[model samples]
Target: MHPPSVRSERLVSPTGRGYLQLESHPAGCFRGVELMRAQVPAPDAPPARRPTALVIGSSAGYGLASTITGLVRYGIDGVGIGWERAAGQRSASAGWYRTIAAATIARDLRSNFVFRNADAFADSTKSETLDLLEERFGGVDYLIYSVAAPRRTDPRTGITHQSVLKPLGEPHTTRNLEFADDGTALLRDVTVEPATEAEKAATVRVMGGEDWSRWVTALAGRGLLRDGFRTVALSYIGSPLTSAIYRAGTIGAAKEHLESTAVTLDALLAGFGGRALVSVNGAVISQALTAVPGIPLYVCLLRGVLGDRFPSPVEQSLQLWEQLTADRPDVDERGRIRLDRWELSAAVQATMAERWRSVTPATLTELADVPWFRTQFRALYGFDVPGVDYAVPVATDLPWPGSPAR
Candidate 1:
C-alpha cells in the first residue's frame, strides 16, 4: 500500500508542479519555514551595539520578513506586535504558525524576541508594548510599522471602521479574474463601484496613518523610542493597470494619509535626531494584495509581463532591510524611500501597459501564467514550500508567543 499523500488546501489543483504540498500540520511544514529563514541575508560583521527594533504587525508578510531579517542581519533584539488568531481545532492562520517559527528561530539564534499578540490599534496594546519594552529591551531605535487590516475600531469612540477597494468618485471597469469552485481560473471584466464619502473616510480610518502617528507619539511621550530613531511604514504604488482601483481608490487615500503621517512622524522624531520614512514597495502578492478585489488578475498578467523579474515578498523585504540598515537607499524627491524602482521602472511599466491594453479574455490563457499565480496564492497560506516531508504529523499548539514557558 502507498503512504498517504498530503492534500492541497488550494481552491484549485495544479495541472503541473513547482508548488509546495501544503500540510495542515505545522510540524510537517518546517521545511518551508526554514526555507524562508535561509533566504534572510546576514551581514558580514555585526553591529557594535545590540540594537532593538519594535515591529508592529510582525507576524506575517512584510512585517514578519522585516523582523526576521533584522534578527539575522543586524543581530538586533526585537519585539514583534501582532494580532493573530490562535490555533483552533484544525489549524490556525499562516501568520500564527509563522509566529511560532519566528519565535523558535529567534530563541535558537539567541536574539531577544518578544511577541505581542494584540490589536496594534488599541490603546491597551500600546501600553503593553511600552511596558514590555521598558521591562526587556530598554528602548527601541528602529520602529517598523507594517500593520494592514480590513477593519479597525477606534479605541476612543468605540467606532468600527472598515476599508473598501473601489474607485474614488466614479465606477471603473477593468479586466479581472475569478476562480471556479473546482479551481479553474477564468478571466472577466469587473466594474468596481465607487466609494461614498463615508466609505472613503472609513477606509482611511481603518488603513490610514492616524494609528501610526499615535504609536510614535505615544512611544516618544513615554521615552520608549530611543534617540536616533528610524521608523518605517511600508506602502505600495503599482502599475497603471491597477492604478484606478489601487492607487487612486479609497485605499489610495488611506496610503496618502499614511505617507502624510510619515512626514508628521519625521518632524516629531526630528526633535531627537530621528527620522520617519515611508517605503513604497512594489506590487507584491502579499496577504493585503490577496484581500483587495481585482488584484489577482492583474498579478497574473503582471507575472506574464515581468517574467523573471518579479520579486516575492521575502525578496522585497530583504532588499529594503539591507538598504535601510547597511547601504544608502534610493529615495524620491519627497524624501520618501523608493524600493519600487524595479516595479515602476520605465521598461517594466511600458511593457505592462502595452500588454494590459492588448490583453483579452480569449488571449488571457496565453498571456498570463495561471499556474504560477496559483502557486504564489497557495504559498501565501504556507501551502507550497519545497522539500517538506508531508507524511509526518506537525504540531499545532506551539507555545503561543508571549505566553509563559511550561
Candidate 2:
C-alpha cells in the first residue's frame, strides 16, 4: 500500500519552487476532484467585448481563483502577473499548473488570457506588464491585486522587509499544530512568541497597500486604465479567537492600511469612473495563509463548524466578481465589499464558540473534519484531483505565460 507519509521540504520564496515534488498524489495531489470542478469554467458563456484586466499576486489562493474567474466567467481579455517558477525537470509550484490550466481553458472558450511570472511589487515588472497590456489589449478595465507574501524588498528605499504572524502586544498563548516534515497530517502543539515593534513595522512594510497604490498610480498616469476600471484586494476579519495573532496583529494592521488605501485610490480613480475597493474576504486555504503561524490550527478548529461545506478560494473569488458586477453591487458603509459575510455570520460564530469551548487534542480528530480538511489542503497543490491519473507521465513543461514580447 502507498505510504501515508512522504518526505517533502517546506517551500520558501528565496529558493523558489524547484524542490517541489510532482510525482504521485502524495507529492502534491494534482489528481483531486475539487480542483477539476473549480478549473472547469461554466460553458457557453457570452463573448467578451475586448474586456481587459491586469492581476497582481495571482499565483494561488483568492488571487489565482480570481484569475480563473476573470477568464472563464467574465471572459476578460486578461493578463496575470505573479512570481512563479517554471515547471522544471521535477518540480513546480501549484500556481504554475493552475495558470496553465486556466489559460488553456480561457483559450478554449475564446477568451484572451496571458500571464507573467514576475514580481508585482517591482517597478520593472509593472512596466513590463503595462507593455503587455498595451500590445495585447489596449487597456485594462479591472485591476485585481491579490498579492500575499512573507517578504518584500522595496525598490525605492532599497530595504528588505519580512512579515510576521505574532500577536500585537502580548504573546498569544494558544494551541498550534506543527505538521510533520514528512508531509502528513501528523502534528504537535507549540506556542508562538509575540513580535517585537520592529518586526510589526516590517510586517506592515511588506504586507501593506503601499505597493498596491504604486501600481494604481503608475497605471493611471500612463493612461492604461479604461473607463470605470475597478480594482479590489482581498483581506480577512474573522473570529476573535485568532484576533491576537491575525486580526489585531501585524497582519491586521497591514490589512487596515490596505482598506484605507482603497479610499485614497478611490479618489484617484474618480476622474475616470474607476473605483478601488478592499474586499474583506474569507479565510481560504492558500500558500500564504497556510504559512501563517496560528492560521493552521485555527482552520482545523473552524473545520468543526464548516467542514466540507467551507468555501474554496475559487468560490470566494467567483462570488466577489458576481457581486461587483451586479447592477447594484453590495458594499459596506465604507464602500468596501464584504465577501466574508458568510464566514462571520451569527450562526457560524455560534458554532465557532461552541466548538472552541469543547475542542481539544483528544477530541480534535473526531470532532473536527480531519479527512475533509486534509483533502482540501492537498487540493491547493493541485493534487488528489479526481480523473487526473497520478501514475501517468505529466507534461510539466507547458508553454511559458511570461515573455512580454509574445
Candidate 3:
C-alpha cells in the first residue's frame, strides 16, 4: 500500500522570540529518530533475561533518548507515555511525530514498544499503565521519569499548578539570548523577578518529586516492581555561571525535592532489591531549556567551549544506561548519578567563563556557536534535519503504530 500523504507546511512562532515552533515536519522527525537510533551502541552481550522499561514523558529530549537507548542498545521492550496533540488543520506536535517514528522504528527492530498519548499526571493514566505493565510485561525492570511540563494538575486535589522560571529570593539580572524576527540572535540583559511564596510552592507541586514518588509507591503497592528494578528521574546542575537563575533558582528548589524523594524511595525499594536514583544530566539543547531565562546563553557558550566533545541528549542517555547497568554504579556522595561530569569539568568551565566574560553582541557569534544553537532548536521541531527533503509533501496524520485502534 502507498504511504499516507498530506501537505504539511513549516511554521515558526509568530513572535519569533518564542521557542515553540508552530508545526513539525514528519519526514524530518522520522529522520531525526533514525539518526538518534543509530547513535545507540549495541550492548556488549545478550542479557540473561530480557528487560522491560517504562519511560514517562518519553516523546522528546532525554526521555525519548532514554527510550531509544532501552530498545536499541539493550534490546528491551518498553512503553513510552507522553502528552501530545494529534494533527488537525495544522499539524501534530513534534513529540507526536517523534513518538510515532520511535514506535515504527522499534517495531522494525522487533521490539514490543507501546506509546500512550495521555496526561501522565492523571490517576487514570497511572492505572492504565499499571494494567499494561501487569498484563503485557509482567512487571517493569526499569522506570525512567523525565517529565518536563510547565504545569500539572494534582490528581487528588483537583488543582492545577504552574511552574515559573524565577529565582527564589532576589530578582536575578543576567545576559539572555533573544531572537529577532529576521532570525538574528541578539544579546540582551534580562531581569527576572523573584517568584512569590505561592509560586515557589506551585513550582514544586508541578515539577518536584511528588509525582515520581507517587508513581513508585503505586507500582510497589500493586506488586508490579520486579527484583532489582531500577528507577531514575532526570535532573540537572549547571555551572555557577547560571546558578542564580537555574541551579539556585525556583526550579532548583523543585529539583531539590526530587533528589530528596530519591533517597526516600531508595529505602522503600530496598526490600524488593530495587533502587531509586536521580541522574544529573549534562546541558543539551531542548525545548524546555530554550524557554528558561539564562540556559540558552549558558548552553550555547558551553557548546562553543566543548565543541566536538559536547555530548548530545542521546549520547548522555547511553552513558546513563551504562552507569545504571553496571555492577557498582558510579555516583556522588549524595548518591546521584553524575552524567554532567564532562560538561562540568574544570577545564570546560574555565574556558566557558572566559568566553562569557568577553562576549558581546558583536562578538556573540565568535564567542559562541549561535548558528549551531539555532539549528539545534529548529531541529527539535523536525526542521533542519539532515537527509530530509522538507520541500516535498508528507503525511501529518500518521497513526502511532503502537497505539491500539479506537
The most accurate candidate by lDDT is 3
Q: TM-score for all predictions?
A: 0.90, 0.87, 0.96
Can you rank all candidates by lDDT, best first? 3, 1, 2
**Which sections of candidate 3 miss by over 4 Å?**
1-3, 6-17, 403-406
lDDT, model 1, position 32:
48
Weakest 10 consecutive residues, lDDT, candidate 2? 1-10
Put down candidate 3 lDDT per residue, 89-180, tens digits, no spaces: 66778898888788877877788778899899999999999998899988888999999999999999999999999987899899988787
Tens-place lDDT digits, model 2, residues 1-406? 1112223333321122312334322223323323543654673657547578788866677777777777767777778877766544444566765665556556666767777878887889888888878887878888888888889999998788999888877767765544444534544544678889999889888888999999998888788888888888888887777787788988998998899999999999989987898888887766676666656766777776776677777777888887656656689998889988877889887877777667776777766666666556666665645565456434444445433211
Q: What is the clash count of model 2?
A: 12
Q: What does candidate 1 score on TM?
A: 0.90
Instruction: Say which candidate scores most in TM-score.
Output: 3
Worst 10 residues of 1 by lDDT: 1-10
Against the true structure, candidate 2 has what lDDT?
0.71
TM-score of structure candidate 3 = 0.96
Instruction: State the lDDT of candidate 1 residue by residue for 1-406, as single tens digits.
Output: 0111233332222222222222244542344467777887777887798798989988877888888778887787868988876555445566777777787778777888788788999999989888888898778888889988989999999999988898998999987766665667876777889999999999999989999898888988888878788888999877777889998999999999999988888898888878888989877667678656667877887789777778767788887776566444567888788778887788877877777787776777777888788766766665555665445445454456557533
Per candidate, the number of residue pairs that clash is 2, 12, 0
